[model samples]
Target: MDLFNPYNLQVITFIVLNGILAISIYITLATGQLSLGHAGFMSIGAYVASILTKQADVPLIFALLLGGLIAGVIALLIGAPTLKLHGLYLAIATLGFGEVVRVIFLNMEITNGALGITGLKSIGSTLYDWLKVTGLTGDSFGLSVLQMKAVLTLLFLLLLFGLVLFLTLRLHRSRIGRAFEAIKADETAAKAMGLPVAYYKMLAFIIGAVLAGFCGGLFAHITTTITPDDFNYHKVVEILSFAVIGGSEIVWGPLFGAFILTTLPEVLRVLAEYKMIMYGAIMVLVMAFRPHGLIGTDTFAKLFDRRRKQAARQAEEGM
Candidate 1:
């Protein structure tokens, strides 16, 4: 059915990008913190990476790392003062901070203000150029230059997502992750246990900020340009919705959610004028019927626990 068409390719690329964004929000939510401002951190990363690549000629990898680091630092600064606020208060503060960041960018000369930045380098084009320089063109790769570019870009982005997923899973099993769960379940009890609830919350926020920044850097390079508008409150809401709608209890949930939501619009294109209406209705249904998301943590936990018990019983019976 021509699944490899250019339009589908672009949608796949965006799915990877949005998956990263969803994971960012998931991290904070996992720690019981609602950060409605990750898009600001993302914008910071995008601009920093964009500037580094366009001006200083830095490598994309290094630019992305530095961008993430900068965003983490900013998160630390912002989180220190704001993380103490709980629930709705924290959400409002983060949302306000995002607005502030947008306003600042809109007035900054370095960012070209509201005019936005363009003419940035595309990772796919960059790889194609590199192949030409290295004399490893279609003859060696068994694919056309354009085809190679798409394959390489997809693989590169998937690798990035794999790393993120691995790290998130590892974090879920770590001491810090246990503390995050403890805090999320009962912040008061965690504090009574001398767990430093505030510190853990701040740490989660910073980690989420770093990941969002990294994703932002990649987004800039992939699209080859970006405007402040791209990382606005609407984008923040959309990214957060991914984690919420997907189920933040498990790392895979957000990735799955990102894939479904990202491709839904394209798949519904046949609906024409009714597509947006349908999309909103679907989200509303999900929220109303599946508040904990499509994937329920309790259900997954019970299923896995049952399997574990069954496996142990089988082993004992074999003996």
Candidate 2:
């Protein structure tokens, strides 16, 4: 199969981006804090990165980092007070914040008032040019310029996702991760045990914001155009579904969820207009059968253990 075909490349790119966004939400959910305003942080990052790259001619890497940093700062500021709220209240407050961000961008002249900034430089083209200048392109690669660009973009995104996944895995075993788990399991008990509940929650919130911001930057560069409408409440719901459907018990769950959800529609393309209806139904069925998600704690272990026991029993009976 031609994985680098434009259509396939676009689908893969979106899956990676959604995986990153899913991880961001999972980070907050790990701390038992449900934040529905990640789209707001993402918008902040997208606009910041887009402006810097388009106007100041900054490098893409630097622009993305700066965008994430700015998003983290905003998360820190708002998370201080809003983090105090729990459950549905927190979700409502965050949803409101996302609306406020969209309206602000819609009215802001710098954002071009809903017209949005277009013609942003494509990272694929930049990478292809760099490779060409470095004498790495041509017959040696056995690929056309377009194919090369698509491969480069995919590699870059995969590298970033791998880095994020590595850090998340390390975090899962870290002291801070344990604190987050404790808080999620029982906030009152965690506080009683002398853990800094508020601080950990804030830290998780900021980290999630930074991740979403980074995702926004990557998304903007890939699409080469971004508007306020790109980061709406619907976007938030989509992101949250990734974490929920994948299962919040482990970091891999959300990524897996993102992969399934992102590609399901494509797989159902034959269904045409009915694809989305099937997609929604599948999600509902999954939720009804596995509320903890497809990969809850010990899911794999139990499955493997059951298989091992069955094999042993069968062997004994045969003997």
Top candidate when judged by lDDT against the true structure: 2
lDDT of 2 by residue, 1-319 (tens): 7875877887898898888888899999999888999999999999999999999989889999999999999999999889999999999999999999999999999999789989988878878878878889835678777777888888899999989988998998999999999999999999999999999999999999999999999989999999999999889988998888899989888988999989998999999999989998999999999998888778888999999999999999999
Q: Where in model 1 is the C-alpha error above 4 Å?
A: 1-4, 302-319
Q: For candidate 1, list the clashing residue pairs, or say none.
A: none
Provide the global lDDT of candidate 1 against the true structure: 0.88
State the weakest 10-residue window (summed lDDT) of model 1: 1-10
TM-score, candidate number 2: 0.96
Clashes of 2: 0
Candidate 1 lDDT by residue in tens digits, 1-319: 6554556667788999898888899899988888998999999999999999999999888999999999999999999899989999999999999899989989999999998889998888877788789878866856766667776677788899889988988999999999999999999999999998888898899999999999989999988889999999888888987887888877777877898899999999999999999999999999899898877677678899999999999999999
C-alpha lDDT score of every prediction, in listed order: 0.88, 0.92
How many clashes show up per model? 0, 0
lDDT for model 2, please.
0.92
